[model samples]
Target: MDERDHASLPEGTHELSSEVSERVRSVISAAEAAANAVRHEAEQSAQVRGRIAEEEAIRIVDEAKGEADAYLAERRRRISELSDTVVERAEKIVARLDRAEEVRRQLQGLADSLGESAEELAAQLRDQPPPSVPQAAEAAPPVEQAAVAEPEAPEAPPGEEPPTGESEPPGGPEVVQLAEAPAEAGPAEAQAGDDRHEADEQLSARLVALQMAVAGGNRGDVEVHLRETFGIEDPVAILDDVFGPGTDAEKRVAWPRTGDSAA
Candidate 1:
């Protein structure tokens, strides 16, 4: 081989080397591009996961808030229902008390009528006519010689009982005036009048005391006391017909109105 041929590269060797170097550089650049694509895909996946987590957290918070609101609303509804029930019961109690008080007033009116009737009856009895007596027979001689004659007896008063068998004096019976009978009775009539007046005063005092005891208190409490004090089976029966009607005298001792009683 000539010196020039030895110094120079073989036929196509340089071209082959140049081709191999170029192919290696192309492979390195392709690998670097693939790595960059993989990194970009990872970044995209991370961003998508972060967004999903944020959405989930927001949804959980919204759900929790919604549940809390519902719970609060339920509690408020229950409270409102309970309040309404309490108010209804209270109103019923008050209505019952008002009705009881009204009944008590009616009873008091009836008691008044009874007192007046009793007074009128007493006055009628006082004005009645006196009873008639039997006239005496003529004076008898000796018991064995003369026959005993019986005198006819007069009719008795409507209210008075007839006397038993008894003989009158020889003179006819003297009729005394009804007005003068009390004078003849003397101290007895005066004492009887005084006793009746005292009884009336005592009765009036008892009624006044009972009225004061029941005043301003609850109707149920007053009714209970009335039943116990009056020996009544039913307190409300004071207004019934069994006790008779009220009179002007009893009506004057009526209970005051609720508002007036407090004052």
Candidate 2:
């Protein structure tokens, strides 16, 4: 080999240093291996941390969704309960109002009936004639004739003579003569009847005043009041007596004869 070639030759080759080169190579390889191991461990740790974070996030979301669903369900239940309570209370109020109206109508009808009764009583008192005294002699004839018609007692059978002051037969009904009442009333009795008549007239006048007040200004209302007061069953008959047929008052007070007219 030429000197120049020898000079260009690598120094380590000229020194024949295989062991040194091997040692240097081993040191470099060790450093590269350690660096690679560190990199691999760091990547694994990062992957594990990312997985844990993702699982935690998913679990948190699931818990939040469950809480939201429960809250919503409770809210809906409360709303339903409140709505039912309000509706129930409103129904009770409406029912009470209806009952009150019905009672008012019934009271009005009762007042109308009482007024009618008073009017009828007034009309009867106005129409009735004063009572007259009965004649005494004319009332006594029938009573006197009845006492004289008894037959004579039949003679006791042949063997039996009638015992003096004998009692009537056993089991036979005893005859009793009732004494007739005097035909003529005393002055005191006649005066008492007059007083009763006067009191009746006063009562009738008071009833008439009550009827007028209840009936107000309406003629039909007054007639209705009168019929109810006197227990008059027939509206037409009361109307006929108070106001003759074909009169306006009669037409107003008379009951309809048929369903068609009533309608």
The 0-to-1 C-alpha lDDT of every candidate, in the order given, reads 0.56, 0.59
Q: What is the lDDT of residue 257 in candidate 1?
A: 61
Model 2 gets an lDDT of 0.59
* Alpha-carbon lDDT of model 1: 0.56
RMSD to the hidden true structure, all candidates? 15.1, 17.6
Angstrom error of the Cα, residue 236, model 1: value is 28
Candidate 1 ranges beyond 4 A from true positions: 1-31, 103-205, 215-263
lDDT (0-100) at residue 95 of candidate 2? 67
Please provide TM-scores, in order, for all candidate models, with all chains considered together.
0.36, 0.36
What are the per-residue Cα lDDT tens digits for candidate 1 across 149-243? 44457988999888764545443232223334544555565567666654544343334334433343333444454455434455443332222
